[model samples]
Target chain A: MTTLSAGKRLKSAVCSTEIMVIAAPDGDVEITCGGSPMGDGATNGGAVDPGHAEGTAIGKRYVNADGSLEVLCVKAGEGSLAADGDALAVKDAKKLPKTD
Target chain B: MLLEMAADAFGDRVAFVDPVADSSITYAELLAAARTAAQAVHDSGAERLAMLDVSNLAIPVGLFAAGWADVPYVPLNYRLTEAEIDALLERITPAYLVTDLTHMTAFGDRQGVALTSRGDFLGMARGGGGDEDYRSMDPEAVGVLLFTSGTTGAPKAAVLRHKHLVSYIFNSVEFGAADEHDAALVCVPPYHVAGIGAVLSSVYSGRRVVQLANFSPEAWIEIARTEKITTAFVVPTMLARIVHALEGQESAHMPHLQSLSYGGGKMPLAVIERAMQLFSDTDFTNAYGLTETSSTITVLGPDEHRAAAGSEDEAVRRRLQSAGVPLPGIEIEVRNDEGKALPTGERGEIYVRGDQVSGEYEGRGSTVGADGWFPTRDAGYLDEEGYLFLEGRADDVIVRGGENMSPGEIEDVLLEHGAVEDAAVVGVPSVEWGEAVVSAVVLKATATQTELQDWVKQHLRSSRVPERIEFWQELPYNETGKLLRRVVKERLDSA
Candidate 1:
């Protein structure tokens, strides 16, 4: 229910998950964690749903099916991420070599 | 946040080492120190945190402390003249200044400044007064401000936000990629972009950092052997010196060294080829980036380097000279002067778009266009396969003897001379230094080259003085009256 621009950090109202937007299409996009809408600086609310008990992994990126939405988990949470009612898939492991 | 992650993952692991001082800090100790030190920085009420010293424990502590304090961390060049450093310090007032013991007495005290020796600062960091809950999570907050000597005017602070640096780390580097035995030798000064990148990247990757405050070929090689170093990043000049130092040694192989990356200036093909032959098993990469991009945006990985070295095709062989493809989440394009994207293999200005790209300065808002692309101003062409070849660092920067100097900085000093009416400084290829500063001037009164050189030496660092100053009747300019520095450089190259 909020504008999701790139670089925006959002928190799940129902979980400890903190995600940073990697890419987003123009306008507002519905993003949820454990069936509850994620928000910027969202406070902890209802319990994590048993149906969404799948935990989010730290340092992994999640993307929507259409590829228009992407978010990276900076911190892990008990609830998994979803975009527009579709569960986001973990992007493939990065192939870029270590250049630092 | 980055440090917190590292501390959580492996608090017992060694995080940093100072070979010169024979000191080291573990991840847990570093986190504790940073948190405590951040309190002092916050209590000082400084708007920014500044460090004017070589790489040491203070470096990581100061950076993390600044992050915790929610202020921009500024690392200044120690090589600049006292007056030059003062000029820069004046710009960032109400600042917390950290310096090594050698510079303890250099500055007495300023009205809006808090100065502390590096040793004392570390004490403060480890003394146990910290805020356990302090954290700056706003991604848009400025993280680091590196002073870049511009092609015109005084050096301006290039801004890097928390997100820019974090994006680079998250995309290019996997968390906890380094094993406990992994160590990286860092020789570049703290002021360079590569140095900052080395610290942040190595820390995030869980590699122990072995820092050498002063770089000597013998010291660098000996430390690598002693520290059991596995990975490292060096600039072109440092690699060249090491290559020369290893000459004629039959048992010169560093088998433990896994990866060796070089950038910050053009790598002489001959130097790289010789090093490759010497260390046949080592992984060599070329990283191309600007301070504004928050470190590496493109990488010429080891595979590409080896492939180019062994390839017989002229184009494939030239890939060694090309900067490899853009990193994931980064996009690059070559465009004509009018900003139209050019086809592959056509020369044009380079522009990049990415979450990591922070094309901003302190006072200036941002150089990025409305479309999110930031013009690099570096002339280059993208090959058919998307390799980027840089014509030079920028059209104007003179990277000489491993130091980057602005032509305008030298030209300004030359113009201060009473005898000079107009001056144009350019870098021309040289045998020893990759590029040597040479200037052409139209004099209003009589002046000798030696006299002008001495004048520059008196005003600025000796390295900035042009090696050669030629008397010219007039300097070339385009129809729009922009000075054609490339023409001057071409004339000097021919001469």
Candidate 2:
């Protein structure tokens, strides 16, 4: 297995977060608490962003948050705001942790 | 380069066979046609030409004509829009655009051959499009300007020479062992190197080529069984679909298959093993090469696959993952960021240098390093046995928090999920970590993102598990059958 450096550890630590995410339409979201910062590392490459990021004090609407998240972006960066609403609908919100 | 040598040595032998139309051409005839085309092109005062329609008959003829005429021929994908073709025409500014009336719109005013007039050429052409007596041309000189499939960005042209194609044929034949009696089936498109290679290799080996106008699972099986195909090159997805199609049907479609070669993207070990089981008698070779090198540089032969695979030995398993040793004439090296060669088993970028190496074309895509070696963006390590193992593309590598993540590694695990049909793992921007490992999956059965996440978390370190999972009916792919990671992500961002 490959070794992870301290900096990578810190990066992974930041990326590995538990948070209650409400998926929003237009890839925009409103984080009630901790989550990855908007535009912190988002790129045009079309890769899925690891919801793991260091959250700052403020929350801004990064995506359009048109109330379109099928599964509440319960975990920041864990998934796309645009998801199969039905697949996520099966989950119970109370079972999710408030902060990761 | 090898083609010329072969032509010189085997001029009168039948070189190309259009199995679809039941026609064949001798090496001498092909050389003569190319020569004639070269003279015609030279007389036409076209220093540079653009070939828009890539029917098998037109491709080799155009290539040889340009070479014989001492001009460069730019190959354009037939799928490109007129505007895109116009833009390319503007960049190359060729004196002529070689195509038939069907695609005449692509060249508003450029001179071309009315393919309707090329009857013999059409019949002799592998897939059978235009029927014209195409001029034969030279063996030497730069020929093709193929564009890269723009999955990441705008497509850029990759310069290809006759030598590149010939050299690949020379090297691959030992592993493939195609002979005059072999009837090879070609289903890949001709615009790309893989497609071009399939056609050229068949011709070079004097084998019969049965062309599939387009790849449909049913059509492939039909053609293979009907034509008694002996060898073929296929992409992973094509293989998967074929396997899926033949799942319960015990048929003779694969009975005549002597060998199966695959590349253009990574294939899961399970997929390959499954293929082995399906075609137990046929030899399997996993090839690894880019368009720049014509087709393949390294191939894992069936023998090595069986010996090194699932040995329960780390060293043996590592060999199984390798792309195999460099071909006889190709030079390969693994280097650090500085371009200095590294010791065996050290991960670094792959660089290839040899007769087969085609320089970057039209100043597009990545630049060649200071040394002549073309920087393969792919990260891999050369082992003590001289085998090369691929990790993934450098751009595709994910650095989550601080740890480097190979999406391929994670993807291999996800492929184990019985419900997963296909999966693409990519890095998304993260404010907290440098990058996040994100996965988009297409499945045979339905599942939620949470379920997938939990499943992945169980198999991998939490750092390697995707922070997000999206389900799609299908993943976007380009013309050459490579997944379009950027397009898939765009759907997510827009969603």
Docking class of 2: incorrect
DockQ of each: 0.47, 0.01
lDDT of 1 by residue, B1-495 (tens): 777778866779999999778889988889899889888898889989999998899999999889888899999888777888888888888899999747544653766778899889998897784578835467888899999844356788999999999888887887777888999999888988778888888888888999988888899899989888898888777887798899997645688998888887656566788889887888898988999999898899999999999999988998987789898889999987689999998767799999899999889879999999999888778887999987643557787988877675577568768888678888999889999989898898999999999999999998888889999998775321246676798899899
Task: Give the per-residue lDDT digits (tens) of candidate 2, residues B1-495.
Answer: 223434544556665545444656666566666666655566666667666654445556666556666677676776777777666667766455666536555355544322222443333433322224422333335667777776666777887765565456544542123455677777777676777777566554556566665678788888788878888888878888888887875543477888787878766666676677778777777788888887778777777777765478877765655677676568899987788899997878889986677766676543655666888888888878888888778777778878877787788678878788788888877889977778889898877888888888899998988888888788877655577767765666454
- TM-scores of the candidates are 0.81, 0.72
Indicate which candidate wins on TM-score. Answer: 1
Q: Cα deviation of B162 in candidate 2 (Å)?
A: 4.3
Shift in Å, residue B324, candidate 2: 2.5
Model 1's chain B TM-score? 0.81
